[model samples]
Target: MEATQILDVARDGILTMVIIAAPVLLAGLTVGLIISLFQTLTQIQEMTLVFVPKIIIVYMAVLILLPFMIQQLVELTERLMDLAISLP
Candidate 1:
């Protein structure tokens, strides 16, 4: 592949990765922040307090987003295959 085509593919790959990961990451961040705020307000400074909820929420978020993530990955894979087939 030409340098420009390679760069384009790399950029697209990175963008797709970010798009796929954003929701779960955001869910974790939001849950963590809210838990932190609650801890601060209630003065409950248990170290393990944050883990369970974050895990559960992140898991739920991943489950909910799984279908969309799979679709995106499939589309990306198909596009990559098409590009490979079209190459010299």
Candidate 2:
């Protein structure tokens, strides 16, 4: 494959990955922010307070967004396959 085609594929793969990961990452970020704010307000500085909630939220987000993630990945794969088939 030419460099441009290779770059395009790489870009597509990266964009797809980012799209798939955004929901989980955003969920974790939102939970962490809220926990931090609560701790600041209440003065309860428990370092481990963030982990469980963040993990649970992220896990739930993943579970909920799983289908969308899979669809994005499948689309990326199909595009790559099409490109390969058309290449040679």
lDDT of each: 0.95, 0.92
Error of 1 at 13 (Å): 0.8
**Model 2 C-alpha lDDT per residue in residues 6-88, reported as the tens digit of each score:** 89988998899889888799999999999999999999989999999999999999889998998998899899889888976
Q: Candidate 1 lDDT, tens digit per residue, 1-88?
A: 9999999889889989999999999999999999999999999999999999999999999999999999999988998999999998
The numbered model that scores best in lDDT is 1
* Span of 10 residues, lowest total lDDT, candidate 1: 6-15
Q: Give the CA lDDT, 0 to 100, for residue 42 in model 1.
A: 100
Native-to-model Cα distance after best TM-score fit, residue 47 in candidate 1, in Å = 1.0
RMSD (Å) per prediction: 0.6, 0.6
